[model samples]
Target: MPCRGAAACSALAPTLPSARTVAAGGQPMQLPADPIEAARTWARHDPDPETRAELEALIARGAREELAERMAGTLRFGTAGLRGVVGAGSNRMNRAVVIRASCGLADWLIERGLAQRGPLVIGRDARLSSEALCRDAIAVFAAKGLEVRHVPEPCPTPAVAFAARACGAVAAVVVTASHNPPEYNGYKVYGPDHVQIVPPVDAEIAARIAAAPFADEVPRVDDPLAHPRVRPLEGLRERYLAALDGCLAPRPERPGLRVVYTAMHGVGAAYALAALERAGLGAIEPVREQIEPDGRFPTVRFPNPEEPEALALAHALAERTGADLVIANDPDADRLAVSVPGRTGGFEPLTGNQIGALLGDHLLEHASCDRPFVVRSIVSSPLLDRVAAAHGARSVATLTGFKWIWHAALELEGRGEGTFVFGYEEAIGFSVWSQVRDKDGISAAAVLAQLAERERRAGGSLRARLERLYRAHGVWVSVQHSVWRPGLEGRREIEQAMAQLAERRPETLGGAAVERVIDYREGAQARPSYLGRAELVELQLGESGRALVRPSGTEPKLKIYVDLCAPADGEIARIEREQRERARAVALELARFVGLEG
Candidate 1:
């Protein structure tokens, strides 16, 4: 629900201000020594009238705890960049925070002489506040006399990434929360390499942001839409589409297959549908209700395609059309979700790891480029490594997120160690080719469509192809479970839980004895190739499987991932069933030991 300003946020305030007052992540809403004064200071400079009124209402009602929570700490740059619920205060995603972040980025760029390197590119999605935030960022950039190239309309996140590299921009900023809920919005920054900002750079930009003036004090020009530096992304889509076409195999053999595609009420339909058609695939049937871009995302609880519920409408359409496959993209169209028909007359959604493995195998099988290699997140299924090895390609595992994946790909490509043929994280994000160094649902969707069609022409389904790959590379199954802990206290609890688990290493997990416990934080030093510092724990359970536990980089939850595999000794069907059952049992046990039950 949209928080109704201060009143709605303050309804739960208690008699006396206490340090234990819960707010975001269940963290104690420690009241500032002078909460009322702090609220007044923040409200005075708040640029958004709605958020200003929100703070004023809380101040008027002596909602000190609520006010404190809102003003406790400014939103800092993280793995996902600046993101939070849209509302008042430094901690939220209101105009004030956006302006400050822009100013900080501007200052960092100018200080580093990056403004002289190239123009900055900006793009936005169809989120409610996206346009407004884009304009706000433009105002700051223009005031600083920096050249800017802006996408005139809502575009996929990858478009901005591609434009940043293709346009030779020093940095690019996309005003989107990606797959976050409707109430949230975010700003993601990409460097000249077109990868997300990492450690030292993020810290430097954050320092500049901390030094930026308050929202109201920030200077701005009259209409950023009329600014001279602002120019539309002319010919960008054509270039991106051409690059996408390069991801598919030559002499494409697309069968007459029925496909159901949905954008999940996002800005992807135009790009995705066009890509599918360009791939010479069969007729496309879109989920009518979800074909258009609607920021409200009224049809689903969350806009993320990774969530099974988000694809309910697409599944229904698939069933009605007897579609051979279902493909979906999140709101920004940067991630993909694939579902195939099941025995019970319903569509079965594939896990991110499953999709990754399938795509990795398919891409490797049709290798055309030299030095072909694959990349996957460290927590993703290890089956991709075996697939790459079987195909005589190298596989590298990096920290979670496409930022690291893309960065590592570039590093490899630069040194001629390998060329990034394909990359994916176990979160429905994939980069079919290195043309765009980010997870691209539009291109990934196109490649998947072509692959599915080819499989269909061979009188086989994706399921059959998957089974074949499993046979070639032993049956491997994986599952992900998350422990939700919202608010600040929840974050602390998650940290404590991780510490407890790490300190008290279990001698056995599930029914198997633990062979070794790897703490990534400690092992990072030993492994120089590891990207960044991460709080992760991995348990190697002999031959049964492996389990990895870590706190979510973006959300207030503890994520646990488990993988189970067996040698392909029996019939494919029996092996698949046994492996799935074994995976489920192992996942359940890991969850009990490290997730919800723990």
Candidate 2:
């Protein structure tokens, strides 16, 4: 059948020989009946030569097991959108999958009468496959008769979110796997509110994608960039920089605060540096080795800043230059990591909870609203509640994920509750200003730098400031442990583990009595409207601490978070050390109960 639409129809046609025509060992290749037919269909529809040949090779060799794994089913488009290894088949992230997803999104927008509200903003990261996937998305949307605003270059995820709001976009899409491996890529969708799509919206769009036409049959503009409905999204960088101005509170310029930064070989260096310069601390040193964007991430084992080894280069640079602080951003610049000079010798990295607490306190102290509020994920440290109480600001807790955190903030502010000052999760994700409705590493880094400078002027270090906060509130410490299990069987094992833990709850952990247990899944009716039901369990341990266990939303792992605190009447250092050890013990116990190792 001749494919319709676009002069580049040949691109969608199979460019390789049929798998049935090739033989292995000079004999007819024998393959499974059902899987081979599906593979052949996938090969015919895949527009990229790499994925097409990949499927063809599998079919030629009669690789039934691998083929079955690849063609098991379509990739699930959940709230986070599509994410998987870059390869052939419907289960992976390829041109065929991206085309279908884009078509479905276009249809969903048109159906909701949102297509005419504003142009759809699209952006990408520096991954090897990001550009091609972004191109396919733009072409699909344009052919569907939606105006598209293309961000032209690799940028931070927060930049895309800001652009979505800046241009008043009906929706936005970004082709970047935030902090995932190089072999992986993703498609993230944002609604008109400039937040990630949640709940019924995600389900609705997924249904549309399921009903979308095959890759080759979907209409696409051969030259989407040149098409009348598509135009270059200009001034995004400048506008994003201007938007970051709110993060820098009016403070005297205290120069000479030596700060070291790293991008982890991602797309955050340029935007971070620009934001810092605009904040007046322009003499920041960049880790030359990992400053630029490289999809392969040659310098680190993983691109995530949460991984200690990922910040090894930045630490080395900070030590050599006698820097005061070190900051880093993940691949897509949606999360921030900070390290300070340790009391012993080398630099010590702060947990995401600690950073969140610090930023919350700082912003609340400087907040101007009569009624200010801060938000945190339920899994975050309870110390934020203490800080908010001290400052007389409301502290709200929601389910994990920035989508919920931002949504909670907006809901409260809209209800005359309070002005949203700051919000963060325990995964190094933060939102410092209201302009960018998502976790913004660029602005967070700027605000952290300002905080460090303010402390320096007062003859105090970040460590000293943290200690002061601990003394004022209580000494709070948090630790996270993850148990990773891969593949389908691993997923089942994880589910079974959760179920077992839920059935037999722990009475005491780390010698702290579990006063109350809150099963988020079971208490949907009693929970507030903003907090939805999820597979999460929380064990509140009175004043001693608390522990939360849930499966990671973005990765194949079970994550456990433990928070412990003590009065600062004794030595703060000794208290923190003891609490950290106790928290680790609690985490290990939880892991054992769940049939996994800590």
Candidate 3:
């Protein structure tokens, strides 16, 4: 038996105390001390009846032993709080899970002496069960005597991030799974500063949440928990649009630019097109099938702008309209991907790296008079550094999460330094506005619409412009590879392999010389430095930038990020040829060892 905290060991089942008897390693299994009550709590009050039934079934079948592994404790809280599949187990996301998390947040705020302040701001995406989960948060926060202001409409995750600053609330919670599937939803917490909680703060908040008690009954306050003080925010939409629109070459006269937009059945379609229209780029066409917000994601299985199939409909529309450009937003519209036709008449879905390079170039040449700096995720392409150099700006690389990028922006702004020209994560999220405070595709789309128009007027296509960019800067090729790391066994297997690789530090990958291997787990890198280690192993590919291999912090997958740099024009063809051959050779090794299917 392990020494466990009281919260971790709380009774998960009022009906069946015997349900937890199970074995790990053929010994009487004991739940972990870290999140002791995780399993039992779910068994008792998780809102999903199906999940609850599933847990009850699992427990009744004398399978409680497995429960120890799943719920030996609470889910570990990272920069992003409590993201997982919706289910009735300790490992899954459920109502009880949310309640516990909210309590933890409330306690943290009270400690900060922010509990008595005006309502906390809560926003949600159009994911299944998201609205209810957000409402549950409002209920709990209101019961705690903390007022609440809910963004009544579905919004991108960044909007909630911005609202944290806009409302000046103590905390902001966004109920979104980000780019995850329909079956998944998550809880994201933003500090009073509108940045995701980092360092001692996240841990401190989790500890408090783990220590706090759940309210048995919803408290009836002067303001109904169901309805926290709601306020109508008008200009936030306009301000974000204006800020994003400024990123383009304000060529308003060319009404000939035709642009196709798609939200991909997420919450961002309306605002994205609106921004484009406001930018005075008239020809705005929406992919009608994906226009409406549907949490089930009927049109596409994966709601990612970078996904090829996700934009198939959008591409078809582009072909139909001969549109100058096609832009697609993910479920929350935080990330944006553009599809421009190639020489072969097949529209090419530009990699996140390609878009970043173009957008960086566009902004560098014509950014706000404030003269902003560019921020990119460490895992993204380094080509932005070249563009920044040309524009006489700087590029800062942070951890993979957008939260890090957001904080980096705030950091620069706080110093009274250059304004944030642009910020992006490899996974398609971009923030063009220093004021909106988070990634806004609406802004990106507005700028992209105008950029497309300007390119048209100059007698060149956006694709042609990209080619010119490649010619000038350098040919940069970046690829993200994901391998399955599903369930307990698979996860363990992947880790064991990682451990072996770490111990034997490979000299090369796919014939490329490995200059350095950054192993995160060793004691050589500690605390503040190790904060970025969410299971990461980076391979520095000589002068061709590097490749980062890490498990997805948000999903059950291992990600391989590859980047190659060469002289601009001919380099694209050279890099493409080399990339295909080298990628094939090296990807095989990666796939074989890492167990990647795609």
Top-TM-score structure, candidate number = 2
The lDDT for every candidate, in the order shown, is: 0.79, 0.83, 0.69
TM-score of 3: 0.86
lDDT of 1 by residue, 363-407 (tens): 877776666888898998899998899889999998888888876
Candidate 2: 10-residue stretch with minimal lDDT: 1-10
Considering lDDT, which of the candidate structures 1 and 2 is the better prediction for this target? 2
TM-score of each: 0.91, 0.92, 0.86
- Sorted on lDDT, highest at the top, how do the candidates line up? 2, 1, 3
For model 3, give the RMSD to the true fold: 9.4
C-alpha lDDT (0 to 100) for residue 554 of candidate 1: 73
- Our tally of clashes for model 3 stands at 12
| Candidate 3 lDDT by residue in tens digits, 323-429 | 87788888888778888877668688877777888777887777544545888988888888878888888888877777777667666555566666777877777
Best by lDDT: 2
Q: Cα miss at 497, model 2 (Å)?
A: 1.3
RMSD of each: 9.8, 9.5, 9.4
